[model samples]
Target: MTTRNIESTDAAGTVRVTWAAANARRLARQGLTAPVDGGPAAVTGAMVGAHAQVLSAAELSVALRLDGGATRESVRTALWEDGSLVKTFGPRGTVHLLPSADLPLWTGALSALPAGRNPLPQSVRMSGEETDQVVDAIADALADDDLTVDELTDEIVGRTGTWAGDRVLDAFQTKWPRWRQMTHTAAHRGALCFGPNRGRKVTYTNPHRLLPGFTPLAGPAALAGLVERHLYAYGPATPQHFAKWLATPVRWAAELFDRLAAEGRTERVEYEGGPAWVVAGDTDFPAERPAPGIRLLPYFDAFTIASQPRTRLFAGAAYERALAGGQAGNFPVLLIDGVVAGVWHQRRSGKWLDVTVEPLPGTLTAARRAELEEQVERTGEILQGTPRLTVGPVSVGAHA
Candidate 1:
């Protein structure tokens, strides 16, 4: 099948595309992308990302336009209906979601990792027999009681044999072991979630089983479905992105995307000036604005990492700082006129969310400056409390 990328449509460099039109195209291209209207009737379900598809809960929620107050019901709806959450490959030996329904196609396009490629140093590496035993031990121990990752990890290490070294243990467990317990959930849907070490009241769930699970995948088809879903929402991505997101290798992702494309089960679009593929069929771009008004995208939002080329979404200079490490390093960002203007952080005070904007090296007209502050106020309202804004120093072009 043929694929298409964006071509210069007009005389001037600007593409006359309406932001709204672009938004629709962008969202539709990835079937898993959804808008969360406040409602109780939305469909939702827990996604068990297989090896091919892997995504963080935060990633899934953001792509679905879900608010911080989103309930399990809302998450499940996005997963089951919009098909955004899939069990696809990603970072640190875990799975993540992309879109929906695209999981299978994406999985099929890639090849699975070799049976025995461990990144751990030889000193701490588990022998084949020991690795098997460790997995078995965890499966047996978790037969009852929902345990935290730390608790389960400690038990596994203790029961395995002896503490070889700190590095050895770190290499062995990595993130997979925890992901395994979380995703498997055995007979239950709940897995061990991670929270700050002390005096913090926050926790997040992971959905992968590095070893085995209570409710293990019925078979390979289930896993394939998860992978396809990922591409549906976060497609037009490189195999590297998939590997980074799924903690798999580029070879596996490349194979999967190729197969899906051959089967006519996927479509390609121009993203960041490259041919990008998605499991969903052809879709149109958003006509006018990508979304209604200025948006305060949360940390790790899809817009942060959706396109393979980070520069497309972020300013050339700010994008560098934001991605000094890699895509995993998510900095909360600001968007004006469908472009990255600056980055911001929130300071929560009881019922208020104060946003501090980091101005770029440009001058802003008085009206435009007011518009930016107004957007910040609307953000405060959406956050449901008093809102305060603080603007920072100005720059050359847009003047501060």
Candidate 2:
């Protein structure tokens, strides 16, 4: 693929860059390509974390990074067996598989803020005092033993009050623990994290016990560190986009952005006529692109979901099809040369894994077509299955 990186500064101190449309493919490849050779924790550190609401998606997300070097079982081992990764609530109040050692930074930065706006009306919401009590109850209950959500809810209501047992939220087609909403609160506060599964049920434990002598940064320090990490991986973004991705208020994101700019930690640039920020001194725009290939990214894979400015990544009808409802994780995406090209799905028949792709017609070259087939086999290898390939639409994901 022909690639170009153009950069210029006008006298008024504004930066402008225009890339041939193919540049979109190159820039994304730069950002999304994983250092799979670096292992699971390295992959987690690079992408921040894997969207883990679906355990299988999280496993596939990390396993795909291996580029066939590892499998779903290897990723699971890292998270459960090796203790190198931790499943916890990260940005946007979602569960993610983050590096175990990064808990201090992740929790310190996230919990410094309050839990999200309650979907329930104010009358039914947990009060600040009650919320704090729930947090305390969670920390206390899971100090020595991992407990399922039901068990923890029982303990929490018992410790706090029967009022805490009232239904407050619904998710994943079931009523969550009244304290379930606060579980994210507990996670952000570093009070709770995932334990080995108790059969089919998910369980929670205290991260403190798993990671000893952890020294969490103070609020401001952690915020700065968090922003830096984000910019390092996904920068040249506006504060508003940052806020949206983090699910924080724009004022909060802007305030942090201002601080980073003031500290010489980041610089402003124009991306498609809009001003954006990047880590200072991080302007490395190489002349050539990485080897072109296809990646069948898992649902909510960091690359597919986290990158922003829809115009930059999606072109023409590709955007409308790839994000049919403007939702990212609803389908596994076919990323050709980094930019999203179409949607895909897989089905299992005994040991055989049948894969399907719905491309934007003419998007795939003979070489990319070959790479797409290779990616299908790689997907099965990562999932520890065999592979078959078919092109065209296939129904998949929860949205369908």
Candidate 3:
């Protein structure tokens, strides 16, 4: 890719590009236009990380981007066997499968984030000193072996004081150990990550064990690097959008964007008539619009979550139909030529998978219907099942 702007207008040097051109570039960058020739790690890295809150969805997200006959098992192998991917807390404090090699960048940037307000009562909340002690104990407890939540709780209470074990923190219909509040913090500090499941229970282990000698790259430099990577995958984005994606304060994101612009590390542009920023040299939008096609994106897919200008991406009926309220990724989406135009669902039994697609009234032509069928078949291949397509109403609710 060239560093020079592809199409510029006026002496002010703002690159002019339409949403069509921008979407084409984004699809190519995200490995959505065609299957990329690489392993799960490369696809995960290109997209920053796959949203692993739903592990099956995350696996499908990566598998759908590969050129080879990659399956969900490919993603599992990378996480459990090859050690190329680490399951840890990522953007917005959600679970993500990040490339092991990029742990330094992720940990460094995430650890530097400004702390959010604690919802726990003062009596149950840990002080700064107490939080630090709990984080230390967590690191030490996971350094040698993987432990389930209950086992880890016991170890943590033993390592620290009884105060750390107080079951006062409110959780899903129950209370948890006060120290459990720092689970995401421990991961951000590069002290913890997911281990292979023992039976049906989840396990936690130290990231240092995954990648020997791993250490986070901290400070402003690391944050700047993260911004560049974000722009690479989803550029022409505003600080507000970046803040939303990272779950940070808009003011903080604006200050960082200003600093990056001042340092000549990022360039401001007029994207579809609105001001936005892209990496200084990454101003090359695709000259041609993306070809008309269909794709099935699973729930909580990274592309749907990270893409910006949501109003445009989810236009017309899509705004209300594909999205839950105003939040993206709650429902599986059907993409027509790169924008969400419908919704879909799948049910599996034995070796057969039934796929249902509900497209906007006139969105699907005969050719597009054929493409949708092919896409459904591809989805079945990734899931290791035989697919049967049904182009009708998808009556299920969000995330059902």
Model 1: how far is 181 from its true place, Å? 13
Instruction: Note the Cα lDDT for every prediction shown.
Output: 0.45, 0.76, 0.89
**Would you list the clashing residue pairs of candidate 2?**
none
Q: Pick the candidate with the highest TM-score.
A: 3
For residues 332-355, could you state the per-residue lDDT of candidate 3 as single tens digits? 999998999999999999999999
Q: What C-alpha root-mean-square deviation, in Å, does candidate 1 show against the real structure? A: 8.5
Question: Using alpha carbons, what is the TM-score of model 1?
Answer: 0.61
Name the candidate, 2 or 3, with the larger TM-score value. 3
> Against the true structure, what is every candidate's RMSD?
8.5, 2.8, 1.7
Off by over 4 Å in 1: 1-24, 27-34, 37-64, 67-91, 94-119, 153-227, 238-241, 268-274, 287-291, 325-329, 349-352, 362-385, 393-400
Candidate 2 residues 298-392, lDDT tens each? 77777666677665566777778777577667778887765778888877899998888888888888767788887888888887789889998
lDDT of 1 by residue, 216-324 (tens): 3333454345456555444555567666565566786677667766766766555554555556554434433334334555455454455444555565766654453
Provide the clash count, candidate 2: 0
Query: If the candidates were sorted by their TM-score against the true structure, best first, what order would they fall in?
Result: 3, 2, 1
Count of steric clashes across candidates, in order: 77, 0, 0
